[model samples]
Target: MNFIKTPTLLKNKSLSLLITARVSSNFAYQMLTVAIGWQMYSLTHSAFYLGLIGLVQFLPMLVLSLFVGHISDRYDRRKIVSISQLVQGICIALLAFGNYNGWITKESFLIMVFFIALAHSFEGPPMQALLPNIVERKIFPKASALVSSASQFAVIVGPGFAGILYSFGASLIYSITAGLLILASVLIIQIHVNKEERKPDPVNLKSFFAGITFIKSRPIILGAISLDLFAVLFGGATALLPIYASSILKIGSFGLGVLRSAPAVGALLMSALLTRKPLKRNVGKIMFTAVVCFGLSTIIFAISKSVIVSFLALFVLGASDVISVVIRSTLVQLETPDNMRGRVSSVNMIFIGTSNQLGEFESGITASLLGTVPAALLGGVGTILVVLIWRKLFSSLFTVDSFEGSKN
Candidate 1:
């Protein structure tokens, strides 16, 4: 595979810096997520609290995303991303202190969760919007591939690393995460965002409504969004992993890390393939097939009793889901005007954020009630049904083609 070509975006230096920054920052972030989950479970011993952790983190992102998107359009994206990352670093460091001192009561943890979530709320929209400015339009697919692969690599490393560190001490794991985040912030500061003419301030409610209105009007974008939402919302099996790791799989926290990382492993492998030779043709059909594969894998995972079997199922789920994600993300970026990227991305954030986090909550609550197997099976079934419904509802989008040739 030739990895030395000049990308469509900025010169190689800028893209390299941005990619490194994102990878380092995400590794830290993912590690913290796993550490926090294990810590919370140890503290509360309730699946409801586990679900609540996801909810609390997601709530701020859902609530303030519109404003964040607006800010990204009005000002310097680099600055916004830098500041938010710095704040997040502090937030992670604070958690470490709390862990070390044993001052991490439930309320304190919840408060920290809310604050970190607020940081993410501000950070996500701007960071996503910044991508188009960093890379050339022609190489957007390649850029997306690199980003996706980096994230999956983080997923592969972070959870497993956290599990090992956590065995020694949660505080140690948190401290390491904090250090990595600070390093990531430093790396982000080195990035050079391609400047563009600024848009008018986002002052009016009508404009806010317009952003929402625009997304709703574009059936291709809307369909892509809904497809992800329904599929992830219904097919998500992450929350039940703890149950599997503990009970059925007969492995503890260490095994849980391996299980959780399985999907990222699959994604990382597929992303490598896409990076070398991009999946450009039949994007729409591929997306549907990928979602179907994800659903089937989830169902298989739900029924599997063996740890190895469950991991294989999750690997398939992860690999297939990446195909869907790449296609949806490429479609959104390609179709959206540069000015509207932030707003559209915010809407995108809302759908995905709500689906995954709320889906985690749903899984947790349902598992608490219906049992893990039933919850997993039902979520998979729901995903399959939603795909069928969406295929009929948004049939026009099923023929989505490369932006180079086709007119939307």
Candidate 2:
């Protein structure tokens, strides 16, 4: 997974390779989740199972967070990532085979989902850590935005495409997902990092918690990371999209795909703009404001019965989220030393995974008890409250004005 350094053009090629690798894998999973959500909800007719799916995915990330950082920093991160994709592909192939044979049940499906999450738990941090290695520091913010663009673009297409393909059967969806994941593995193998020496310290208990310690010590980094963690923790309504598609908007699987892809559409557009012109001023204020916008969009989405209005709200939501993501990612990578980036990234991943997967569980339970619309509205309002509180708590983050800050 590690290769010799080459020219600047090769660096760009490596960057492209990284983005393609990311896009392929991300696209595959986006499709996988779309199909899985539809299948699970169809079989059970329960939103709780959807939350269970989130819980299954989340337990692994929470359990594995301690060790993943040490492994990423100490081993070949690219190999780790490629191997993770390989495992996921194999699991998807098993899913396809099982579905074809007519033995896949909800219980069995969740078991498979756990393994997929297990593989993904190893994948996330290493993948995040890989970006800084590809491009020079000066160009990293632009490259980071480009990497986000690839992810967003994948999200934009994969679900909508999955909805179209889903008419054939779950087996077809699973088969295609497996193939794309394998392609991602292949692409990851081709990426060559710059000659950044990976100086891994010997593994110990201390190393496991180092990432957390590192984050807690840096206020700007801490502020950025925690802001995303809590904001999205309350704001995310991803786990409930299936319910919305089927019951609320009455939009079937294709409409579900459209609703799912809507945010990514906005995110892709925003990321493209950022790639062209990275944020130059008021970085902290911009991120906080973006979170507030995200909350407002969620509220709009929760209340809207009209398909067009919901999609538009989601579009605005995606655009707002990318702003927070790009700023937080840039700050985390730019400030951390290379040796600690993986550990730091692992901690960051835990927060991200928690905010998303755990948030899914939160949405699911809330939806089950309070009804979907109320649950979603609560999330939107909670997100805004979190932002207001975080601003007071993390005052250091609000005054910061640029990406060119003190590097640790």
Candidate 3:
């Protein structure tokens, strides 16, 4: 937190507002995730249903990503973000009401998740595109590090808060999440962006596909994005945390909260370090190395029985992931032009977001089929293999020495 005070990027009013908004929104998201995962698992007692949560959320975003990207490129990104937050807040509120009335079912819960995912799909690209506009290019890494820190801090606090609140009732947690989301929306609305005055171009198929085309054209960007996609898809163990908490670890809800927070705690620590000493050399090689560590950590986590060992594995998992996040985010934002940032970011979001959701589904199905231990072990091995294959396929990515050179 002290590092946030030292960064000159925080001195920029708009960037500060953006960071505040991100923290608030991420807090709500983290809380909601805890509540939903717990509720779904408690209701169905099935990992598959928990996995279905990801599937339901993913479908809407997959469908809406291109349109959302196009809108971000053309409209006031601030407004788009604010509106999405408002919609998500409303959805959370409705979910709370349903739960309170005892009318919510698994079917209804999945439906609400779909709506929330729709809002998030719209929110992601513009929010990403909006960052560079608010900060100086020279301090982009610092800004990114601070922003990531805030987000991870929220992750650290939100689930822990949810665990305590959940002892009372899930309705209480949902109500609180709804309020935080609305607050995030208000905070984002206060940030001002200098809108470019340009002739409005008609929406067309070609313009819609521009982001995809641009990413495909740049091998570095493609490499970075795809690397994350496959790595997370195979290595992520998030979807099965509930199973781990209940069956394998026997720690219950509070322990589940701790397990969820472990990664964020590690990420927060790493982000703080990065803010002090941002990566200045061998950025690409560092990213690849971090990902391989992520895979190895996940494997350790998968096999561990002791809570202490599990937490440590997850902590390392989170730490390594933050390294990859900082590097990849900087590359994507700096490499793209202003006009194309929205679209490119949208494409990037699709890749990243899809990997997460689909990864959960993969975890769920694999756990159901192969059992949790083997499934997670398989994922870890797959992640390492993806890294080896990517190293060969995207060899140019590893040679890059600086973020400055990543600019397209």
Candidate 4:
């Protein structure tokens, strides 16, 4: 197949800077995730505690998403993202200090996780909403692909880097994370945002809940977002990776890093490919098919004992997920108005974010009760079931032919 020529999106300086910031921040966050999971497991050796880490991080989004969305719409989104990155950097620094002095306990680590989550909760809506402002509507898919690819590349590197650094010490891993976050904040600060277009309405109970109301009115958007929500909620196998690395696969931290990086490696490659040749026809069908493949890949990963086979499954999982992500992101960005983007993106975050973190919690609880292998096997099955149910409930989504003409 002939690769499409590069689009003009890359020529936009603000978009380039935004992608840089995303890559930097995501790299730090990915490393932090690996470090924390390893440390949490080492400290407690309990799946429940590992699950609680996700819950603690997600709680802030659950409680504050509405307010955060409102703020993103009303305030300077660039500033919101920069400030949140700074706060997160400080939190990482504190964690690093605690780790360095041998003073870090599970409680302290969890506390830091809460603050990190709180900062990110404030950052999520605005950061997502800012992209449309930076790129033209015609190039949204390419822009989204480039941005997602950058983050995926970070995901691939971050865990492997963290795993290597872990042999040195947890403090080293966290300290580096803090530095990367600070750098990300600096990069974000350099982007120039046009303020003339921003017209935020006064904050009120009605305005706060506007995002939820908007999503409800749009069946296609609602269906697309909810499909991901339930599928990932049941299908995600990431939370149990630590257990697999330790007990099932018998791989050490190095192997864990490789496993964590495998999906992103696939995702990054797929994302790069999408940028070259954007999806056009049968978008909805493609998304549904990719998700089913994701479930099947998860099942393969769950049952595999060989490291190579597990990596291949995760690679497929990541590749399938990128197809869904590019479609969903393009749909959400194109369907919503600029003023409402922040709010809509916030609602989107709640669904996708909750699915990720809550999925981790569910995996932990199930692993505790059903054993790790069975828990993951069941999650894969649940993902397939969700796809079937969603196909029936959101039949409109299945018929969507193009991202540009998607109806709200």
Give one digit per residue, the lDDT tens place, for model 4 in 1-408: 123355476567888799888989989988998999999999999898889888998899988888888888887888888999999999889998999999988998889898999988988888998888887788889889889988898999999998899999999998889998888898888887654465787778888899999999988899999999888988868999989998899988888899999999999999989988899999999999999999999999999999999999999999999999899989998998888888888999999888899889888899999989998999999999999999999999999999876885
Candidate 2's residue-wise lDDT over 98-190, tens digit each?
Answer: 999999999999999999899889888888889888888887788788788878889999999999988889899999999999999999978
Clash counts for all predictions: 3, 0, 0, 0
Error of 2 at 323 (Å): 0.6
Worst 10 contiguous positions by lDDT, candidate 4: 1-10
Off by over 4 Å in 3: 5-7, 195-201
Tens digit of lDDT per residue, candidate 1, span 372-395?
899999999988888888889987
Q: How accurate locally is residue 91 in candidate 2, as Cα lDDT from 0 to 100?
A: 93
- Check candidate 4 and list the clashing pairs: none
Total clashes for model 1: 3
Runs in model 1 lying further than 4 Å from the true structure:
1-11, 405-407
TM-score for each model = 0.95, 0.96, 0.98, 0.97
Q: Of the candidates numbered 1 and 4, which has the greater TM-score value?
A: 4
lDDT for every model? 0.80, 0.88, 0.88, 0.89
Please list all clashing residue pairs in model 3, or write none if there are none: none
lDDT of 3 by residue, 203-308 (tens): 8998899999999899899999999999999986888998999999999888888998999999999999998899999998999999999999989999999999
